[model samples]
Target: MTRVQANLLLLVIALIWGSAFVAQAQGMGVIGPMMFTGIRFLVGALVVAPLAWREWQQLNAQQRAPGRREAGKITALGVLMLMGAAMQQIGIVHTSVTNAGFLTALYVPLVPVLGIFFHRHWPHWSVWPGGLACLVGAFLLSGASSLQIGVGDAWVIASALPWAVHVLMVGRVADKMAAPFCVASGQFFVTGLMALLWALAFEPATLQAVQAAAWPILYTGVMSVGVAFTAQVVAQRYAHAADAAIILSSETVFAALFGYWMMGERLSPSGLAGCSLIFISMTLIQLIPVLKRRYS
Candidate 1:
């Protein structure tokens, strides 16, 4: 896919993720965070498993081998994914919603910085300003008057590191393997299996709890984890990792919109301004590279 098309797919994924925030939130009320995360992603894995098998069938003899190094990378990616998901689920409980929202956006800038520092990959210049703007906008959109450090806040902050790494790794693995569905399925299963183990060890899981959270679990599993994450893996093949981060960060904007519509949450003037800046910044990031290609 073209970069633009890939980015548009990321935008759609953001929308789905944003809308699922309510489901995620409600899910936490009745289910343990680990249990909810484990079940949802396990469902997602099952949903995508058939497609992964199909992709496996088409691979040549060499590609089908599941090299040890590649398997290690995929396993690490799954651990990162589980870490990100589990942290956010746990963190949002003790922190203010605004704090959680603002802190989660930290990954936008972290993606490129990590790439540059470790992977020796430099992002386009526009990514710098655009990413910072998105960060600021996320802060504003979060509606936080002051930054406070708390247990939940710290968890949320920590989540950003794994999330940023996961994004970078996803692009690298997809590029190396050229099998998006397989990567997606493998990560989902790994994440789910690990999370379930954690849940069983620490959290109480019962049929009643699962039934109470069933809709939220099913929606998030099928739509957010299964479809959206899979598409993200596919799209990241063509989209720059840094640029994709900026686009995916628009999930906070979508979250606000969904909150307003479904939960009667209202956006203030500052929130609206933050939303505008986010839109403008994303546009600039996406447009600059296109312009460079066209004019150069």
Candidate 2:
């Protein structure tokens, strides 16, 4: 795909993810987080199965056989995905959809920060300033002026760490593997299995609850996880990672818009400030280097 096409795909993926936050929040009203996550990912796995199989068929024997290294990466990705998804799902029960969307976008900033430990590298100078902006935005968004954060908001913020880790891990795996669709499918299956296990252990999941959540679950699984994730993998191949991240971060804006339009949700003044700061920080992270290069 051309760069323009790839970026547009990322934009579409962002819209899917953003709008799905509303579905996720609504789904939580009918089922526990674990059950919702389990069913959604299970549906996603099924949706992507055919594409994964096609990708597998094109690979040679050696590549088809999962290596220890690749297996480890896939497992790690699945674990991170589960953690992030579960946290976000649970968080949705307590927070506004707008809060969930903005808080989740904190992952865009956290990605480079987490690299310090995992990749043994420091972030750019721009990241520090941007990180500060995100922190302030988060503080305002959480309504911390009252010296308290809602439980769901806290959980969403906590989930950003794992989300960042997942993003970096996906990039690494994408570079090494020829078959993005297969990797995406495998991770979805693994996440689904683990989430189902969690649900069975702690949540009172039932057929009735699943039926109640069916539409939201199906929409999230089919459009958000299956199609959006596959599109991300394909688009990233043609677009620079920084540019892709910037476009994808627009998901937060889309989420807020969807939340407002569909549910009549509105953010408080502090919340709007938080969203604005977070967005400005995201833009700075991507724009700084370009400006530096151009002026230098």
Tell me, what's the RMSD of every candidate? 1.5, 3.5
lDDT of each: 0.91, 0.78
Question: Candidate 1 at residue 123, lDDT?
Answer: 91
Query: How many angstroms is residue 59 displaced in model 1 relative to the true structure, after the best TM-score fit?
Result: 1.4
Those runs of model 2 whose alpha carbons end farther than 4 Å from true positions after fitting are 1-9, 61-65, 87-106, 120-123, 142-158, 235-250
**Candidate 2 clashes between residue pairs 3 or more apart in a chain or in different chains:** none
Please list the residue runs of candidate 1 whose C-alpha ends up more than 4 Å from where it truly belongs after superposition: 60-63
The TM-score of predicted model 1 comes to 0.95
Write down the worst ten-residue block by lDDT for model 2: 139-148
